[model samples]
Target: MEKKMTSGKLELVAAKKFAPYGEMYKVVDFLNKTLKDKQVIFGLTKDEKGQMTLSIYET
Candidate 1:
């Protein structure tokens, strides 16, 4: 599972297929809408198939 935190909200994304860049793009877009020029923090863990536990914090 993926967990996310931002200035506006905090939520989770479910575990899924191995797509690094694509998943990150979704993360970035989510932050952009929520943060609007704020800072971002990421906590990440990955497995062999590139499945990940991703966390984001924005301030």
Candidate 2:
């Protein structure tokens, strides 16, 4: 059987990827440092101010 997050809790987490600087690398670093045996979900989206941002969640 496949496991799912449906029975677990998801928490919103944030990481920085400043403009004209490190982007994906920063996220990777964050994940390498913080991630353990849990699960993660991520995506790219624009903010209200029209800034492209990355969203990461722990489940």
Candidate 3:
């Protein structure tokens, strides 16, 4: 699954081949690092219902 977070909303793209596992953390970490380096605002995580959520913020 791939996701971009914006304005409290998560835009996600999932590939059937990719299984959700420890990879999820990797994705989140990657996004966080990229956003920080680019000075962009974003967030990534699973919601209370265990659903993946990506949120982007105005920078």
The candidate, 1 or 3, that scores higher on lDDT is 1
Relative to the true structure, how large is the alpha-carbon lDDT of every model?
Answer: 0.54, 0.56, 0.51
lDDT of 3 by residue, 1-59 (tens): 44434434433333123223556667667777777765454455664666665545445
Each prediction's RMSD to truth: 6.7, 8.5, 6.1
Mind giving the per-residue lDDT tens digits that candidate 2 earns over 25-59?
A: 56656675666466776645555665565656677
lDDT of 3 at 32: 73
Where is model 3 more than 4 Å wrong at Cα?
1-22
What TM-score fits each model?
0.28, 0.39, 0.41
RMSD (Cα, Å) of model 2:
8.5
Candidate 1, residues 9-42: lDDT per residue as tens digits?
A: 5333333444566567577567667776655444
Instruction: lDDT for model 2, please.
Output: 0.56
| Best-to-worst ranking by lDDT | 2, 1, 3
**Alpha carbon lDDT of residue 43, candidate 2?**
47
Instruction: Give the runs in model 2 whose Cα sits over 4 Å from its true position.
Output: 1-8, 15-38
